[model samples]
Target: MRKLGTVLAALLVIMTAGWAGNAEAAKGIVIDGSTTVGPIAKSFAAYFMKKYKVPVTVSESGSGNGAKSLINGSCDIADMSRSMKPQEIAAAKARRINPVANVVALDCLAMIVHPSNPVRALTEAQIGDIFSGRINNWRQVGGPNFPIVVIQRESNSGTQETFKELVMKGRAVVSGAETQASNGAVKNRVSQTRGAIGFVGLGYLDASVKKIAVNGVIPSAATVKNKTYRLSRDLYMYTNGKPAGVVGTFIDLPKTPDGRRIIQELGFVPKY
Candidate 1:
């Protein structure tokens, strides 16, 4: 009788583990990547979870990590501020992961300076010079007489990549520039440090820091849409192949009016 009881207990444990595994297989939608896009993804996750009673998790490591997660089958989707590179695409293809890109929003990579800097605008060339260690003093660009303190995003940032490609013209970011992990952090640094200059997504713009107009153009939807905002780029999500289940549903949700409103409320340009 004791032996039979022990056998029954073992079987019960195995059955329970199997059931839990199956249950987990049907659980949440996992999104990982770009810190610049994390807030938007988190907002969508919250709304989607509330409306559908489905679990959704969002992670903001960096765009590179996000693409890696998608290829590794570790996430349902990867939120990216920049487009996937060919190598990333090829890697996903090798993993039998067909990455399907969904353009969720348009982002303006707004350049920010300390509020008291007094430089209301900058041309693309000036920006490049600043980041490339060419422009070193605020007085050179109609600001206070102080040495410029350059701040930059970490190498993993999608926003950084976009900024380099668009504003830097493929030039390397200057050494000794402070590197921050997220857009919010960069904004905070720029806000607190006078003579400091940094770049962030449009959503991160606020009174603590002043946005510098690019080539006499502002970082607005109108300017971006009209191609005047040179630092604008489309934000995206890449799914391992065509997303099914909750991820697919959530991606499709943004096409609806309610989702569009959510996007707008979060300070992103609505795709729909």
Candidate 2:
């Protein structure tokens, strides 16, 4: 009778473990990547989980890591503010992963300064000079004689990449520039530091920091859509191959009216 009881107990444990595995598999849609896209992803995830009754998770690991997560099959979607690099495509192809980019929204990579800074608009050439360390004083740009505090995002950030491509024009950022890990971090640093200039996704812009116009073009829906906002870029969620089933449903959220509302509410442009 003791032997029989032991066998029954072991069987129950096995069944419980199997049940846990099924639960784990049931909670499978995972999203990871860009801090710039974090708010949108989180909002979409909340809507998805609430409406569909499926478990979903979102992580803001930066765009590069998000690509890595998708490449490694750890995530269902990799959110990115910039297009995937050539080498990333090679790596994905080598691993038999076909990455398909779905543009979820649009963002104005806003140039921000401390709210107290008076320098309002900068020409493209001026911005290049400032970020490249050729111009280090706010006085050089018609402002007070304060030393410029140039803040930038870390190398792993898609926002940093887009900034480099658009504003830097192949010039390396000044080595003395301060680097932060995420959009929020950069925003916070710029907000606290006088004469600081940094860039962040438009969603992160608020009263805490002031935005500067680029080349006389103020960032707005009309400007960006008209191609006058040079800092505007498309936001993306990449999937392995084309998404299907629930993955398709989640990826397509940005196209729906509710998704568009969420995007607009978060201060990002919708890609209707």
What are the root-mean-square deviations of the candidates from the true structure over C-alphas? 4.1, 3.7
Q: Which ten residues in a row have the lowest lDDT in candidate 1?
A: 21-30
Measured against the true structure, the TM-scores of the candidates, in listed sequence, are 0.90, 0.92
lDDT of each: 0.88, 0.92
5-53 per-residue lDDT for model 2 (tens digits)? 9999999999999999778855668889999998999999899889997
Model 1 vs. true fold: TM: 0.90
Q: Once superposed on the true structure, which residue ranges of model 2 sit more than 4 Å away at CA?
A: 1-22, 25-27
Point to the candidate with the largest lDDT: 2
Off by over 4 Å in 1: 1-26
Candidate 2 yields a Cα-based lDDT of 0.92
TM-score (C-alpha, index-matched) for candidate 2 = 0.92
| Window of ten residues with lowest summed lDDT in model 2 | 21-30
